[model samples]
Target chain A: MSDLQARGHEDWLDDVAVYALGAMPMQDAQRVRAHIAACEICRREYALLQPAVGALAESAEAFTPGNGPIVASPELKARIMRTVRPERPGAATVPQTDAPVRRSVAPRERPILWPVYLVAAACLAIALISSISDIMLSGQLKQSQAELAQLRSRTNALASALADRQAAISDVLAAGAKHYPVDNGEVVRSGSRLYIAMYDLAAPPRGHVYQAWTLPKGSKTMAPSLTFVPDAHGVAFVSLPAGAPETSAVAVSLEPEGGSKQPTTKPLIVVPLD
Target chain B: MTEDAVVLMERVRKRDADAFEALYDAYHRLAYGLAMRMLGDASTAEDVTQAVFVKVWSSPELFRTGNFGAWIARVTRNRALDVIRSRTVRAETDLPQALPESESVEDTAFARIDRELVRSALASLPDEQRRPIEMGFFEGVTHQEIARRTSTPLGTVKTRIRSGLRKLRAQLEMTVTT
Candidate 1:
C-alpha cells in the first residue's frame, strides 16, 4: 500500500483547508507540508483544494479602491531593471519608440583618432542629460499622484460635512437647536441648518472617506449621518434629519469613499451627543 | 493569456526586457490584490508586489517554464505573509467577530470565479461558517487565533472553515461548469 493509503488518516484532511487558507500554526503547517510532499494522495487533495483556498483572496477583489488597484510608482520598473540587469540597466526604460539597446561585442583593436574620444565624450554627455531628465520626470509623476490623492481626500471631507449638516438640521427641527463647542470644533443646531465645525482631522483617499454615524440605544445599525469634506483649517459641517434619537453616540470613521452602508475601516472619533 | 505567459517566461529566461514588462503588467494586479488584502495597507502592498517581480526578474532560472501564474502567486502570497508576520505582533483577539460587510460586485481572475459569483457564494454561507473563514482568509488570522477570539473550540473552528470552503468550491464549480 502507498504511504498515504497505509496511513489512512483522515484527520489531516481538515488541516488541508487550514493550511491552504494559510492559518495553520508554523509547526503544524510545516508538518502538513512535509506530509503532503511525501504522500501522493495528500498532495493530490492539497492541489485540488489549493485553487479554492486562493479563491478566497480573489473574492476580496470586490473591496478594492473603486478606481482599481493602486499602480506601483512608475519609477518602480526602472528601479527594478537597474537591480536585475546591472550592466545593462538602461535597458529598463519604460516602453519607448526608440530602438532597443544594442548588445555587441567590444572591438579588440585600438582606434587611432581624436574623433573617437570626441564621440565617447558626446555619448557620456547624452547619458548624463538623459539621466537628469528621467529623474525630473519621476519627480513630476510623484507630485501629480500626491495631488490626486489630496483632491480625493478633500472630496471625502466635503461629503462628510454635508452628511453631518443634514443630521443636525433634522435634530434641530424635531426639538430646538443646540450649540456647543466640543473639543476641536463647535456643534451648532439652529433651525434646519445643523452645522458641525470639525477640527484636526486629515482627509482620506478614494477607498476611504469621513463618515458620521449615529448610534441610538437598543438599535443595531449606526444610522449614517453624512459624508463631507473639511475646509483648509480642518473645519466642516453637516446637517441631517433632526428627529434623531436622544442620548445617541455620534461617531466618525474613515471608510470606503463610495461610503460603506456601515463603517468598513477604523473610526477616528466617537462622541455621545446627549 | 496562459500561452502568452509561457512565451513571456521563455523570453524572460533569455533576458528579454520587453517580455518582463509584459509579464509584470499581466500579473501585477492580482499580486497587488492578494498583498493588499493580506497587509491591509496599499503602500505596503505595493512594496511587496514590486519586490516579488524584482525577485523573478533577477532570478528567472528559479522559475520553471510552465505554470507561470501559479508560481508567481505562490511566491507573492508567501512574501506578503512574511511581511505581515514581521511588521506586527499577532494579537489573538478573543472578541466575537462579524462578517465584513461588502456588496457582491464584479471582478475577475484566472482560476477563480468572477467577483460577483465569489461574493454571492460567500454571502450564502451561514454566519457560523462564514465568520471563521473570513477571519482566517481575509484577516490572515491563524486557526488557533480565530478559535481563541471567537471563543469556539479549536476543532470546531477547523471544521467550520473546511465545510465552508467545500460549499464555496461546490458553488464555484457550478458556475464554471455552466
Candidate 2:
C-alpha cells in the first residue's frame, strides 16, 4: 500500500478518475470496488470518492429550466375544451357549436410579478457596494459611471442569454475571440405581453472593463438550455465566443488578472450567440 | 382545460377578445413555468409562453395531436433554443465555473432538493473533493484538468476523487435511508 503511494499508482488513480467521470468500465470498476471491500483505507477512499459519483448524477452546474410538475383539473379540461377546438388556421371557422352556454372561463393569464431577481440584485448591490465603495468612491464620478457600466454589461449579457437559442449571430462572431451575452430571466416585463430585449454591451465601458464578443459563423454549438447548466437561477451561461483555440466559445469574464484584451478569462457566464 | 380556459379558447378560435383573456388566465402561469424551465429564465420563458398563447389565440391549429401542454412545451423549447442561439452567450459546457452567483442560499437549498440531492451534497464537499469533481463534471475534465487545477499529480487527484466519492455515496445513502 505504501508502495502504491510511493509509486504514485497510476492504475489506482485511473480507477478513481473513472469513477469521477462516471466513465469507468464496469468490470474494472467492480474490481476496484472489490479491492475497496477488502481494504479499509480503500473503503474510506471509496467513501471519499462516492460523493463524486453522486455529483456525476447531479449535473449540478446550474438551474435547468424545468416543466415544474404535472398538475391538471376538471375545470381546466372543461375550460380548455371550451377554448380549444380542432383548430384550423388561415381557414374559415367550423361554425359555432351548440352549448356555448354555461361557459366558465379561466382568467387571461398574467405573468407572476416575481421580481425575485431584481430584489436579490438590489440586495447584492447594497452588500457589495458597501465593501467596494472605496473603489467606487475613490473616483466617485468614475465609480458611479462604473456602476452603470457594470449594470449595463450585466444587463446586456443577461438579455442576450434570454434570446432564442438556434440563431447564429453571436455564435458566428464568437468563433474565435469574443464573449457572448448570457440570459437571465430574473427581470420580468409586465403587461399581458413581455418584451425581452437582448441588450448588447457591445464592448466594455472602459479600457479596463471586459470586451464583448459573439460566436463566429458556422460555429453555433448549442449551449445547454435551462435544462442543464450551472447556476440556472441567477445567471445562465450560454456559449462563449471561441476566442481561443482551446476555447470552443467566447465569453465576457472580468479580469483583474486582465486576461487577453480579448477575454483571457471566462466570462461570468457566456452570453448566448457569443 | 379549466372552465375559463375552455371558454377563452373557444372564443379565441372564434376570435373573441373577452374569451381569450379568460383562457389566458387559466394557462398563463403553467405555461410560464414550463417555459421558464425549458428556457431557463423568467423573461424568455414569459416571452415564449406569451408568444405561444398569442399563437394559440391567433392560430390554435399550431398544436398537434391535441396535447396543448406538450405542444406548448415543444414550441417553447424550440423558441427558447432559438433565442439562445441568436444571443451572445454560447456553448453547452456544464463547467462549474458557469454557475451564476445570483442564487440565494434558499435557492441553492431548494435546487438541491428539487434537482439532484447529489449535487447539493457535492457542493457541500470539502474544497479538495469539490474542486476535482467539479472539474470532471463541468469540463468533462480527465484526471489531467483536475491535476492542473489542483496543481497535484494526475494520480493524486484521481485517488482523492475516487475515494472521496465512496465516502459521499455512503453519506448520501445513510441520509436517504434515515
Error of 2 at A22 (Å): 4.8
Instruction: Give the candidate number with the greatest lDDT.
Output: 1
Candidate 2, residues A74-154: lDDT per residue as tens digits? 343344444444455756565555866566899999877858889899999998988798666678888788899999999
Off by over 4 Å in 1: A1-8, A38-41, A65-71, A81-274, B65-67, B90-113
Model 1 lDDT tens row, A1-274: 5888444456567777777666787556644543443334454566555566656655665566665645566676677666655776467456666787877988789866777789899999999999999999999999999999999999999977754533433342222455454555545545434345464447667566687777766676687778876654344555544344442566777877766688876666666655
Q: What DockQ values do the models have?
A: 0.17, 0.10
Q: Which stretch of 10 consecutive residues in model 1 chain A shows the poorest summed lDDT? A: A166-175
RMSD vs true structure, all candidates: 23.9, 22.4
lDDT (C-alpha) at residue B55 in model 1: 78
Q: Which stretches in model 2 have alpha-carbon errors above 4 Å?
A: A1-13, A19-274, B1-120
The DockQ-derived docking category for candidate 2 is incorrect
Q: lDDT values of the candidates?
A: 0.65, 0.44
